[model samples]
Target: MNEIESYIPHFIVHGRSRIAQCECASCRAQTPFVTNAWSNQVRHSAQIQCDSVSREVLFERDAFKLHTQPSSPGDGEPLSAWQNNVNQSCINFLIVEDLSIEERLHATGVLLSRLSRDDLNESDASTPQSIGDELLTLAVSGVIRQRFSQMPSIDRYKRDYLRRLAKVHLRVTPDPIASLAFNLKLTELQVMSDGFLEDVLREIESSRQVEAFFGKHGHVWTNYFLHRCFHDVFPGAARNAYDVMFLDLCLDLFCLRSLCAFLADSDVELTEESVSALFSAWHRGGKECLGRDDHVDPLLVGYSLITRKDDRYGGCHER
Candidate 1:
């Protein structure tokens, strides 16, 4: 066999073994072996084929490490029990709740920097829709929201960094609930696009795996969205009315009613008349805008249709 051809199997073996090792030092050492093997194989000749092979092997080795290595704890700190139990890639995500906003953003940046194209591919292979949900969850947690908003305004560099990281995470991870959660949180941070919210709705409408994910986590998702909308998205400001409308269309009847009740309980200026008008507009757009059938709350679907009919007939309604 040619030198490059002979080294391919050894490179693959070492690469796979390095991926399987959870220890930091062992994994780091094994990575160089794969790189050095390729370098040695191509040392005698600078042929195009040998150069291409070297590039491919090194890319694969980097991707493998990116997907498998856990975030190392800070100096003097040890890995938590939860970190040890979960997949290495998820260690930082699992600990996000305990971190301050600054620390959380730093951790998020570290995690994002480690993600590779191979990790996205692997996520797609395992779960097409909920890919990277755990990491997305960390980005949108209650602690993140509270801390992010309470802090003074972000500088341009940090704002740009967060915006880019959030965009990349959304592009690679297609989890519908995570998309909503992250979009709302990022919107509060003033680092998100209106187009992203629309894209998230489209993802929910198109992915069957998202339907299943919603069935299991629907309540939690609804609660997160509701809390954010009341506290951040719709604070009775004139400029926020448009955001309120956007969120209204995104929600179904149950969540819409919950939002209305929340607004009523608070001193918000959103009246029942305004909410009803928003729902009417949403219903006029039909199911395509409403999202996938299974992703919609079953109770909301039936009740919303009934409410629409009642509204059309001018019947007295209390919703």
Candidate 2:
């Protein structure tokens, strides 16, 4: 093993590793170097958690540092402080938190909604709406930058197109939904704090404009999948759950489209048949592609076998 991989031993115990608690002098000296190197190494890769075991240790140290530091100076304005910190560390925030893109956006929106309730002077430039818009813009750009950080210039053309498409679909196409969501949130009529039932209810009971938009787009595959998976479990009065499900599917499709475009540009031949077969396996089995030490799905194994032989695609490993 290399010097970097050797550090993994210090954090491993009984075949499990925990990065948050390692504080040896050797770790203090070498952890940052390892993480920085691993960060570049893992960019745009789809390896499982085991592959990242060593890197996670390093990342946890950095996150611990960030967590210990005050989010902002002593201004005592939480929203303004978050705006400054997010503007400066948007990509880092996503990485350190290990949140999916959707989760990060939702979390940011929730924080914005809660913080916006604070009274602000009229002269303040960081109005709730302005700060929220800026935060959203930063979030999108940060994801794009991190996701495509290692792609070639040729593939980057597709990445740039995706960036624009994401901007339009996320920011423009969903305006009515955003407006309705904002109004519903202002009402604070939540039925439950932890479950998505209340959120589904929000979409179903929204205004006619929102209802019409969801109704028009309700025939998507995501709606079908959610219906198949969830209808029986929550059978009664859940007819309108498609309103929320299809919106989720729309966002997922955008991610899939972006992935396909990049892979195609990288000379990974993709046909309708192959794509269908891939998703078919995921549909029949499951889509939880996360890493396990003893087993990996055949789909990922095959893809990795093909990509690992060539340096063109980003990191893929042989188990």
Number of the predicted model whose TM-score against the real structure is largest: 2
Candidate of highest lDDT: 1
Model 1, span 1-319: residue lDDT tens: 2222121232234444433442332233333232212211211111111222222232332212121222222233332222222223333332333332223333233233333223333223233113335545645565444433333431232223224223221210134554355344433433455555444323323334423323333232222222222222221223213222322322343333332332232333332233333222223232223333332232222222212111111111111
lDDT of 2 by residue, 134-245 (tens): 6556544665234333323322212222333222211111246543443333233223232343333223223244223223432222222222222111111222332232
Error of 2 at 14 (Å): 31
Model 2, C-alpha of 4: deviation from truth (Å): 32
User: Which lDDT values do the candidates have, in the order given?
Assistant: 0.30, 0.29
- Taking every candidate in turn, the Cα RMSD to the unseen true structure, in Å, is 22.8, 23.8
What are the TM-scores, per candidate, against the unseen true structure?
0.18, 0.19
Error of 2 at 295 (Å): 45
Candidate 1 at residue 133, lDDT?
57
